[model samples]
Target: MDNLSQYIDWFRHSSSYINAHRKKVFVVLLTGETIAHENFSHIVHDITLLHSLGVKLVLVHGARPQINAALSGAGQELRYHKGLRITDTDSLQIIKQTIGAMAIDIEAQFSMGLANSPMHGADIKVSRGNFITARPLGIIEGVDYALTGVVRKVNAEAILQHLDKNSIVLVSNLGYSPTGEVFNLSAEDVATEVAMAMQAEKLILFVPQRGVMGKDGQLISTLSPVQADLLLKELAQDESVARNITLESLSAAVKASNKNVHRCHLISFADNGALIQELFTREGNGTLVSKDNFEWLRQATINDVGGILELIAPLEAAGILVHRSRELLEAEIDYFKVIEMEGMIIACAAIYPLDEESGEIACIAIHKNYQESGRGDHLMRALEKEARKQGLTKVIVLTTQTAHWFMERGFEPIAISDLPAKKQQMYNYQRKSKAFIKTLR
Candidate 1:
């Protein structure tokens, strides 16, 4: 019963994400390692589920390991220049054969309809063609890259047409040139470019590990492009670290983010349901590389009163927060700061002046969907900064249920009498909210 209730709660929470992602375009990169993993079928099943939910998917696949095996079987050694394969005529032939076979296998997986399977009755149609145009990498530093190429253009119109028809578009790491030659390409690069050209809502890359890790080995859930670049620079400086797949995917994510792709996610192919979790859950199972301004924090206006009230109504009903009328909020709206994502206020806090030396931080609330993701901490910090800017030396918060949270942020317990005289006179002893104060240096 408990598990069933939890499932119901989770489903209810996921409704918002479902509506947000409906009819959105997503470009997913599947490396050779990802495709070869045992969980590949599960990933395909998830993709089918997304398709059924009206998500337009463009799948870009790589075949480096397969190409290497084929080259070894043909008694040819793999050659590379600066992490890019140096594809000669013979190598290109082998790569084309390997990538084509893999594409066929992927299409077959999408065609699965066994009873009791996730893909059963999915009826997914996949489209693939000369959707990518390429130009050779050319010679660099006295070495010729031969048939190795980079994406010159993506046929966005053709891909959109397929997407409009509700077919999943499949693209291989092979690009066709105007000269009638197919050049070997990087799957990550292809995915990034396709996302940029199509203006996709998301670019999801499947890596071997559980997203980007910090020095403490914990997954870093979010990063701005600048932060990602700094991390990449730090990784590059370490001589013990060889160029790996994760770094490549991160680089691609950063590139996509810079090119106007709003969200680029790096998720693990080894973890079952990672894709779905990353997409639907608030605390995602991956690292997100996005623009810094994706979420805006600013002073709330009269237009934000409705959102603010909606955000705090549940807390007010539960007696975790004191209720305020819309008229009262509109008149004091200038004192509030809100964190807005997609024009919706997800978190908000207000600083009311109690005296010249101190202020009261009140009405702190974060939408349940955004809780536990650090928005509360962010709002608190912003409020503290605002308090300091107002020449205040101390900030006080009264909480019935979040006393520990305030203490964690350097607030110390204080008596109601310790609050400013004006605030103390107006305090309601009936609610019995605990008072805490922080001295701002």
Candidate 2:
């Protein structure tokens, strides 16, 4: 009953804690559903906010309604046997046009908007590449699926190459085979295939209603594939999951999770800023499917500093963290935090106040043994805590490297002028560093 608005507020509270403590890359899947213009506008606004936050979005749009309209306009009746759309030649042609128009409309909307509409307020930098390889679905349940195809392969390299350029990758649920025939693939299937192949950090599917809700009217924030399967089994008998497309989208998510894609989320096309609420917040807007715990955020403390220093000292000596003397560290002892597991520190970061509502994150270091295991991320979040307790407005980091890691965690690189006087002075001294800032409020 609280709705996504409550979740967005919760996310804001948790950000100060998460940003200071963790550092890592994340991906999200945004599955599109045709909805009323007002709801579409709301969804667009949500996407804009997420885009503004520099969150990576992989958009997979569905044009079932558009396809239906095209089919009807072309004097063809739309039909589905079981869950599969009955597509003949006419249907396939309509699908291609409908999907192309939908992609253009999405681009147009993104182009028109200030944030979510375009990439970083420049041109329409989002890319819609040729990544899918298709194969005919043939027949299932004694019905011929015909030219209807399933995704056989995705060009993950091409997609990543485009994403690395800060461009959104738009996927049409239609693909072409080597034989030169077009096949209409399920939108859900396309989104999942790309996400799984790319090993996306997060996958999100958007639907008409507020996302996956319990019978009691509460949001199901997170669910594993097994749990979702059980829920779906009951819904199969009960009609409880509301929209059927949501079920389709979720089914795709479950399958994606079983593969390498670790996290997936479903959000409402009905709410404004829902994507931002889900991506930037702790407990997101919709139901999340993953193989692991998503509560991967927490607070950091002084006790975490010693081990954190151990991780950082090597990097510091190597000229990564600016050489700060032990006396200086003792003087700023309250600024450090570390990731602890079984009473051992594996990673660390430090936070220093920039202003009443802002701070500076520094000295991020991960032990080589635990380099990619998320320990460094744990420490970055700790730094976020120190800033929040001080009522900071934002946190900045100066890194000679690690831009990609910080970007994933929602930090934006800026010029030295963006920093406060004290931090700027320090930043200028460390001429080799690149500056990044994450808004705290």
Candidate 3:
């Protein structure tokens, strides 16, 4: 396709995301290293695009690298105890200077308006203030953290006021105490606290690469809070694994997910379009950490077999789903994923890979009580992600009554001959299930 055609197609698909993200609160955390990277400008432009689309953005920035640089220049040694910085009086001054300078630089970048530039005519108002309250870490194991502190509270009301007025709230990794003292804070903590306080839709953290990769060297695209915690434990115990993981960003993502932030994203700061790609596409470019229970979706297990049977029994009796024996379900349990609510499986779906580039989406069933709420769509999308991970480029569904629904979600009618030879042979003529195929990009 030509560049123009590709652009048009991208914009067409991105329209849904544009509509979905409007007025949604997104807390984006940028590390000092990210700000200093060459890709920072591209990230800023994407952020401006989001702002233009009416997203309420809160940018939390860190100055760790800048502070270390300043301290080194001033001949001051950096001290740390158990990964917590020991900020003395002299180092505190450097921290403040570094943070203030980086904040000013960020504001300057956002303020840019040049002809023929991405920022042209993009009038983005940035609001920055001491919206975070903190208390000193004080004494820990006979070690006084001095000016280093943890986030005690976030002034969400003030931040929301700025957001309500269409201004991007800028928060640095520095907090003010009630005693009129300033302390160095962790940017991840600040972002997490702000997200929780405001109940933001997402807490996006910038990492050095795509996202959390598994031992197999592939990106783990999605993770529940429980999964993230387990991964953290593994990383902590294994030195070789720890080298490949960004412990801090993953920790924050897990925390935000657990605290009901709805979604937390770990995106690569070095990738110019990671943010946009993650937010606006069906298969996001980062790792998403979400809750595992009632409000989330996850892989099915042997324990979920009973719930799956209960969920599909109604559909099976109505002839909407093919009946599966308990033995079969147990044997193929790993092929399914379900959405549970209060200990009940409300929806379930499974995908069986037929070939290197094709799969069959089957056993899709949603509870009668939740038909119109888009649960089916959720299951389909989850299956698509799974299909992609399996190296499948296309997914086909055999349905007797849900053809129209699948078609609405971009599946197209296809003849049975188009399916894999084995699948075609297995097709029962009496049931006469319609075949629908969807190509994954």
Best by lDDT: 1
> Which residue pairs clash in candidate 1?
none
Query: lDDT for each of the candidates?
Result: 0.91, 0.70, 0.88
After superposition, the stretches of candidate 1 with alpha carbons farther than 4 Å from their true spots are 238-243, 292-441
Worst 10 residues of 1 by lDDT: 235-244
TM-score of each: 0.67, 0.59, 0.67
Model 3, stretches more than 4 Å misplaced?
Answer: 238-245, 292-441
lDDT tens per residue, model 2, 1-441: 587888777766866744532322234434444443466765665565555455566777777766777889999987787767878987787787777777787887777635544334545466886789999988887889887789999998888777667777788888889987888888888888888777777677776666776778778888876677667766555543346767776787778776656777788776777766676667767788875752233345555555556667888787767777656766786666655544556556678777666778877776664466455666766677667767776988888868889999999989888677887765555356888889875
List residue ranges in candidate 2 displaced over 4 A: 1-37, 113-122, 238-241, 294-441
Error of 2 at 314 (Å): 50
**Alpha-carbon RMSD to native, per candidate:** 16.9, 15.5, 15.6
Q: In candidate 3, residue 86 scores what lDDT?
A: 94
Quality of model 2 by C-alpha lDDT: 0.70
Q: What would the per-residue lDDT of candidate 3 be over residues 126-155, giving only the tens digit for each residue?
A: 999989999998899999999999999999
